[model samples]
Target: MNPFDNILDDEEIQELRKNHNHLRIKFNVLSIFTIIFIFSGMVLFKREKFPTYLEDLLNQPPNRLLHNINQSNRSNYSNVENFQNSLVSNLNGGKGTIQLHSQNDYWRESPLFDALKSGIISIETDCWYLDGQDYELFIGHYKYQLTNYKTLNSLYLGNLNKILDDVNSYNYKNSIEGEEKKGVFNDDPTQTLYLTIDIKNNPELTFKTLQQNLEIFQLKNYLTYYNTTSNEWFKGPITIIISGENIPYDSIKNLTIRNTFIDSPLYEILDISNQSNHSEFELKYSNQLSIFASSSLEKLIDYRSSSLSNYDFVKYGLNDEQIQKLKQYISKAHELGLKVRIWDTSINYDSLYNSLKTNIGINNKGNNNNNIIWNQLKELEVDLLNVDNNVDLLNNDAMIAAIGVSNNNNNNNIKYHDIEDNYNDINSNNSLS
Candidate 1:
């Protein structure tokens, strides 16, 4: 050790120590600056809005988020009530001129709740019954989309039963003389929620299974039912309408009392009433048998054979002839005391793009072709406007103005124009063929 110590001078050793300390200080300063820069960069990035993906993830509706939470915890009834409360709070107390019908609510719980939050009164679910499935009815637009959890009871019937139970119990507990049974909407208690079930397979078998699934609601008397004994319809919080091709009318017809009703074909109402050679099921169609008369817009207007497609209705708007035809079908339904719902009114992305490209110089804020067709439908006095994207339409203020209704209207009653006078005025100029 002494031999090594003698190899270098004391001054040289002190100089080496000073240089090492200086290097250590510089490294420490660099590290502090590096950390500060990274933190500052993170702060700046966060100050701006989240990236699109993150934003979307965070912006999911509370009900949907709760649904996921509920999936993991099956026994959480409070989550369902939370979902219901969130939906009820977002409802516009009164309905607009035309009630909105959700086209694909069967996809999931989110869409159904989304439509309800957007003030939609009519909800549709596509149900299929297979020979060997555990559930009586599975809900989906296609067979491949079905899941064990998406049964008729799980997605719709059971949820509705719970909602009605909670709503009625709360109303009865708080009000004097047990307030007349209320509906899902706290703002509009008398408003009846229309639940349209589109049977996709085995109409007879599927409908029978659906009846079994509805026993709970039937027992609770929460469904609007026709009593053959009294020859009258007793209004309730919910109305069940069966729709789809080859609907087994015989199953529901001739019942002493039934909570389920049919969705009569809108285009053939006049034919069924006037023709003698029609089927017995067709002949029995009446206000007592059905609540809603529905058909595709193309079918009602006889536009299937035309060069133009159903999407063209959004682009070119309805001609005078088409308008007259729609009016006739709508008037016929009204005369029979049935509400009319026109579907297949969605615009494809290509059509929307083309429309925007063509209307470059015009004021097209809310005057898109879709809005034009919506206005036309409302003017035609169609009761329920079947919409594919109700959330987008209801959220757009300018579109709401174009449709001529304030979503903020808190009136207890929905104001609908008298169809007779409105129909007469439109037909005064040209006769309905």
Candidate 2:
């Protein structure tokens, strides 16, 4: 070691030390800037104001869609009637609209995809054909790169012939009159599901494989079919999907769905209402289910003023009595065999949950609009829950989700079941962010 050091030039050694020091200093400075840039991007939108939230947006109605997923003010969606007609009628034409999300939203990374398993009425997941494997389980269409939390595989490959296996399975038992269950991954008819798989691996192979799988169930014109192969969207029997190229990578909804399932490999639309598309077992379980409503019509359907320029949905302020009126629509949707739910009309969190879970009268929560939203949803006895939205969705805290449902709903008394029973597993992650 002494001989080698003597051979090295003094000037060279000095140069080496100076270069090393400079690099170290530069690296430290860069690290600080990188962190700041990342966090700054989180709260700000389009390099401007903070991202809009459902609550704040609910409080403030816009005159028109300030923003949309695809092109702005799409002539295709220039009017509200045109949009509704596209979804409810002319099902053969037009792509379905998906609400993009932001990373800051609490639901962006929770277990929404998995949580959907228990009482899901409708499920939509995009597919990617990148992997050549015979099957995929927990990957999303979006490619993950340069994540702060982890490293991702750095290649893009794809496959063909993705099947919603266990799509139709039979379960038999001896209970109060044993019954057989059907559908992919469900053991009970009362637990059927409408699974929307977005396929995009091998375009040509997707349809053939999906059709082949449909035969496995021998569906009775009720539970079969998917447009998972194509990126077309429709509200009818044949619609497949909307393009993925335009999605805001940071959207809350996108992150939630992405973390939940595997990327699809084909293309085609899946409509749960299409009885011919599924078997009886699937129809019974997934076809008709419940959903909640917001206090105001605008909030209930997410019909922003910009989205529905013709109707001044915001001009008519929502009140306690008016919130109850929303039940009329819920009942109407129910008549079509859908469940009804009400949420987000007010700020009294605890009282609303207690009343709904136990049928007890609310004491702490006042005669506010949220109370009415809770009462309306509970009285309807909705089978599903679209619960409270926490601004800090990244935390995925059950304390936020179960803010009020635990205390009890009836008898002005808190019951044990409210906390112990009728709630989703807290350990499981959520994507409500």
lDDT tens digits, residue span 59-154, model 1:
554345223343334334453364344324334434432367888775423545565555567899898998886346988888898867667776
Error of 2 at 262 (Å): 21
Task: Give the best candidate by TM-score.
Answer: 1
The backbone clash count of each candidate, in order, is: 0, 72
For each candidate in the order shown, give its overall lDDT on alpha carbons. 0.64, 0.29
RMSD to the hidden true structure, all candidates = 12.8, 20.3
What local lDDT score does residue 416 receive in model 2, on the 0 to 100 scale?
Answer: 14
- Where does the lowest 10-residue lDDT sum fall in candidate 1? 48-57
Model 2 CA lDDT for position 359: 39
- Residue-wise lDDT of candidate 2 within 1-433, one digit each (tens)? 4667777588989999999999999999999999999887764542123112221222322222223234333444433333332211121122111111111111223222222222223333444433443333223545451222110111101100011111111112211111222222222222233333444345334433433443323222223221222311112111112123222212212221121122111111122333365553232222111111113224554444454444422222344444454545554444443233233333343544444333333223322232334334445443333343332321222322222232111212221112121112311211010
Candidate 2 residues lying further than 4 Å off, grouped into runs, are: 1-124, 128-179, 182-190, 193-303, 306-325, 340-375, 380-383, 387-433
Mark the regions of model 1 whose C-alpha exceeds 4 Å error after superposition. 1-87, 90-98, 170-180, 278-284, 307-312, 346-370, 410-433
